[model samples]
Target: MAHILLADDDKATRDLVKRALESDGHKVDLTQDGAEALDRLIAAPEGIDVLVSDVHMPGLDGIDLARRAIETSPRLKLLLMSGFAEELDRAQALKSPNLNVIIKPFTLEQIRSAVRTLIA
Candidate 1:
């Protein structure tokens, strides 16, 4: 019942995540990079409940995207995913009740559960 923006460079990951959230009845917007995701969020900051993004991308990475997203929409919840532990560390500065991180190779159930918890 929420609107979600998912950003990832990997097409397969994006599709999988989109399907996962969509099946849960969320309206999912797909973006190939953090820059695109930022643009979408900026263009329409309203109604986006959660942002599930990959921590590393081409132009704008998820960490920076999260920062900008919060500025654009402070109420937005964030789920930043990454395979690299270093990137996860970079997210430390963004620690908040609204922000969470998932290690890569996550299960669909885990992601769904995380999102549910985030938006709860």
Candidate 2:
């Protein structure tokens, strides 16, 4: 199972994602914002395999988080989620390999599949 770092301000979304990933037997670490997420990533002695974040957050939005995270861990797989078209567009503009985006209002199955594919 992969160690996953998930960052999202919305509690429901965070919990939902955590639950979905956990069901797949992945060990998921949750963060409310990108800053905390970055901190966790840096502090992690055992590296994280995947990062799933919300594009819109209180501080250190997903795009910037993705940029920094990728720099810090180049092999890190990333998935940015957003309901806003503009935010998704912003994520699309980032120049990072192994980066993927998903629109919000997705099913648990979809998210699970996305992560499965991401780590595959």
Choose the strongest candidate by TM-score: 1
Tens digits of per-residue lDDT for model 2, 3-94:
99999999999999999999999999999999999999888734899999999998799999998888888889999999998998888787
- Segments of candidate 1 deviating more than 4 angstroms: none
TM-score, model 2 to reference: 0.95
**What RMSD value applies to candidate 2?**
1.2
TM-score of every candidate: 0.96, 0.95
Q: Considering only N, C-alpha and C atoms within 3 Å, which residue pairs clash in candidate 1?
A: none
RMSD of each: 0.8, 1.2
CA lDDT of each prediction against the hidden true structure: 0.92, 0.92
Q: Give the 10-residue window scoring lowest on summed lDDT in candidate 2.
A: 38-47
